[model samples]
Target chain A: MIFKIAWRNIGRNKRRTLLTAASIFFAVFFSCVMTSINRGVFDKMIDDSVTSNVGYIQIHKKGFWDDQVINNAMVYDQQWKQELAAIDKVQTVIPRLQSAAMISFGKITKNVLVTGIDPAAENKLTNISNRVVDGEYLNADDQAVLIGEGLAKKLKATIGDTLILLSQGYRGVNAAQVYPIKGIVSFGVPALSSGMVYMPLAAAQYFYGANNLTTAVVLDVAGKEDVEEVLPPLYAKLDTNNTYEVMAWQEMIPDILNLKQTKDSSNKVVTIILYFIVGFGIFGTILMMTRERQYEFGVLLSIGMKRGQLAASVWIETLLLGLLGAVVGIALAYGLAYYLMVNPIVMQGEMAEAYTKFGMDPVMPASVALDIFWEQALTVLTITTLIALYPAFVIFRLQPVTAMRS
Target chain B: MNIVTVQQAQKTYNPDKIPVHALQGVDLTIEQGEFTALVGPSGSGKTTLLNAIGGLDLLTAGKIIINNQDIATFSDSELIEFRKQNIGFVFQAYNLIPVFTAKENVEFVMLLQGKSEQERDTRVRELLTAVGLADQIDRRPSELSGGQQQRVAVARALASKPQFILADEPTANLDSKSTADLLDIMLELNQKENITFLFSTHDQRVIDRARRVVTLEDGKIISDERVS
Candidate 1:
């Protein structure tokens, strides 16, 4: 009966109901849009740092991460590859040999971190092959090299062009050689272009003069297993005689994880602020509603209504308003998120390259997470309902006789 | 059986530091099945006395007994419930809820009493029919005539079957013919249902028909006459 009365009362003031619901609608809608943008950007950042560059798992020589240019560079590439291949959820394992080297092209020489990769095996594991926009990648017999687009532009080198590389090889010996510039690659990363170079594994091994092997193995796994769960098994399979380490990508990419944490904190910051503003909007509507119905409340009180019930009845009105607004807002936001994900708003020129120039995916993406809708809707609605207590309680304390006398 | 009794009641208001004592230790008693008139000129305390007895206004110092329970000390909620179950009021202005229809206005009292659906509907229909508003049951207060609106108030007053009806110049806003018709209905209802009726008014027509009359002067009852 209380609910019946409340329902009738809401219908009695159509304008008040509309105003309150509109407040809730806009609040939830704005919150949905903002949260979608935040999540979209964060998800893309994570994809660029984690999924594309580093696999969920990576294997390395023991103590190499701590002191990469030191004694831990002591692992055989073939044995480790066979042992890693024995595990399930291990999609592909590609070995790499990295060295700090000085390379010169004619009169211009630059210091670089030279990466040695098995062209065929690395192609299967990473899509580095597909990134080649100029010249062919390393063939079976060719001592070809892949250089970042920026590095090539700086070095003024092109396909089939011979570039000299000079570096400190094993045993501190002077190592120098001539390798053809195989391809120039462009990635989203700004630094990768001018600083990094990829060479054939056999040629690097022959040039370094100290190994038939690699310093670390970068493993790319299937999604069936996560980092923490599969890394332990991969470790047990490794030479635990302190010879090798099976480190998860989480360790290698601490900066990425830290960045994600910061983004999450900021996401929460934005969500709270947006929802709070929405709350104020809804609250204003509820205030107007209660003030307009002050006399109605007085009548209900005089009619022997329990004050608490009266308040509950009013709150239920907001609940209905919230539910209605939430459903509509989420539905509208869903369409928006979908449209944006497909026909992504493209950033033009340097702005697009700037993000990609930094190894960050430039496309903005939005998630259609349902809980986001429920969370935002409930938050705004609950706040409006709580504000309703001022009016509902007013009825309890009101002197019906005096109120009527007015 | 007496449904209400008021003893030594007083209500004072201060306007610009000059105290206007509306009721000063006024005493009165009303019996069931009685049609009583409280007569006095403006500011003579008749309305104040009626307000105090109806539990609509608090007394400065008094004992108000309604249906044998002292209600002067009742809390706001308690007084509201007491009024809902025991007393119905008809104001000179026809105070019907603007949002509700004539039938819903009549159902207001029963709604207060927490009557079940079937009971409230049955009682509301009976009262509206009695007041000759059966055809106008769905019409809101704004749509009704002065006489029709006052009749709706009367229907509402009787809806909860209250023991006493307190009317403060109920016919003051109506035409003479409408006033005569309303008085006739009240007297007929009083005789048939044994529902007590009390009015605070200066209208001699009301006083002439009332079985008992109480006249007030200077905030106190000056005469109590048994006219029947």
Candidate 2:
């Protein structure tokens, strides 16, 4: 009976109910949009910086990350790659032998990081073929190099041009190679696009006087979320006993993670302010509803309805309104977020230029993650529930004769 | 058998500042099955005395004993329970719940009493029929005429089958025909079920139909007359 009464009571003043619901609707919608955009930008940042090149999880010699010398390089073992691949969610294990060297073309000489890779495996990890702008992609038997677009531009070199590489190899042996440039590849990160050189594994190992050696084994997973699940097994399977170090993407990219955290903290402050406004809007409506129904409450009391029952009815009424608003808000937010996700907002003018200069994508997309919807809806409902306590308090303190007189 | 007894009932409004006495040392007793009227002008303590007897308001100083239970000894919650079981009320403005249909209003009290659905349905139909609103049971208060709404109020008041029904100016908003029709229904219910009624009103029509009339003046009862 109380539920029936509460359901009917919400229809008593349609305008008031709509106004209250509108406040909650907008609060949920705006909060969802804000959080979604924030998360979407950070997800893109991780995709560009970490996932595309270094993979989400990496395995290297124990001190290789701290000291990138050839001495710290581990022997490239197929058995280790097979063991890592057996772990769940390990999509691919890419091997790379990298060292810093100076490249000279014509009269210009610039320092570049030379990376030795298996062509097929490296393509799976970074999709290098799709990023090639100038010439043919590298083949396992091809004694050629894929230079970054910025490096190619700086050296005034193109396809069919030979570039000289000079560096100290394993055990201080002089490592020098002259390889024809097969292609020019671009990267979203300015640093990589400006100074990266890719060569086949056999050629690079022979030139560096270190056969069957690799500096890092990059483990590609489906997404950043899979890193945690794949880490424990990888640790147990590999020789982590002071021989190798397993690093997740977050441990590799502290700067980007810190940036996301700072943005998230600000988003929380804004969300708090929005919910505060929503709370007051709902409280005002409840106050008016309670005052208008004071006489009716008195009659119900006089007719033997318990105060607790009456208060429960009023609270249920508020919850019904809140639920209605929240459901609608979620639906609307989902539609908008999904649309934005499919077709992101493209930056224009100065913003686009700035983003390109920084080697980042200029477009902004909203995250369509399901949790964002329910989390915002739950928060608004909680605010409405707390606001509803006002009516309960009034009903409990009401005097039948006095309220009826009013 | 006396259903209610009041001794030295005193109610002073705003006692701390310029107090106005609404009831002063009033004493009265009502018996079972009696159709009684408490008649007075405005501010003459008729409603105040009615409120006191109905346990809607606390007496400043007095003892109102109903069915041998001293009501002043009951807590606020106990008084609500006591009223639910023992007293019914009809107000001047026909205080039917606006959101409810006539049938729902009548069934509301029984629902509070936690009566079974079968019991509530049977009693609600019976009471609405008794009030001459049998055909208007499905209409909400806003849809019904003032007199019909008053009839619904009467049905609601009797839904709990209380010891007595207290009505304060029930006919104040009704026309002559509605007033007469309403009175006829009440008189029939009174004689047929032996149900007791106590009314506070200035309407001469209601006064003429009552078997006993008590008149108040300046917060005190001035006359008690029993008509044949």
Q: Candidate 2 lDDT, tens digit per residue, A1-406?
A: 9999999998999998898888888888888888888888788877877756778988899999999988788887778778878899989888999999999999999999999999998888888899999998999888999999999989999999999999999989999889999999987667888899999988889879989888988999888789889988887887888899888998888888999999999999999998898888888888999999999899889889889899999999988888777888888888988888999889999988887776678988889988888798778768878988999999989998999899
TM-score of chain A of each: 0.81, 0.94
> How do the candidates score on chain B by TM-score?
0.95, 0.99
- The superposed Cα distance between candidate 1 and the true structure at residue B20, in angstroms, equals 3.8
| lDDT per model vs. reference | 0.76, 0.90
- Clashing residue pairs found in predicted model 1: A188-A356, A188-A359, A189-A357, A189-A359, A190-A357
**How close is every model to the real structure, measured as TM-score?**
0.79, 0.93
Q: Looking at model 2, give its docking quality level.
A: medium
TM-score: which candidate is best?
Answer: 2
Model 2, B104-204: lDDT tens digits are: 99999999999999999999999988888889889999999999999899899999999999999999999999999999988998999989999999999
**What is the TM-score of candidate 2?**
0.93
Query: For residues A303-370, what per-residue lDDT tens digits would candidate 1 score against the true structure?
Result: 45557767887877766766666777777887898787677667778888887767866677776767
Q: Give DockQ for candidates 1 onward, in order.
A: 0.29, 0.75
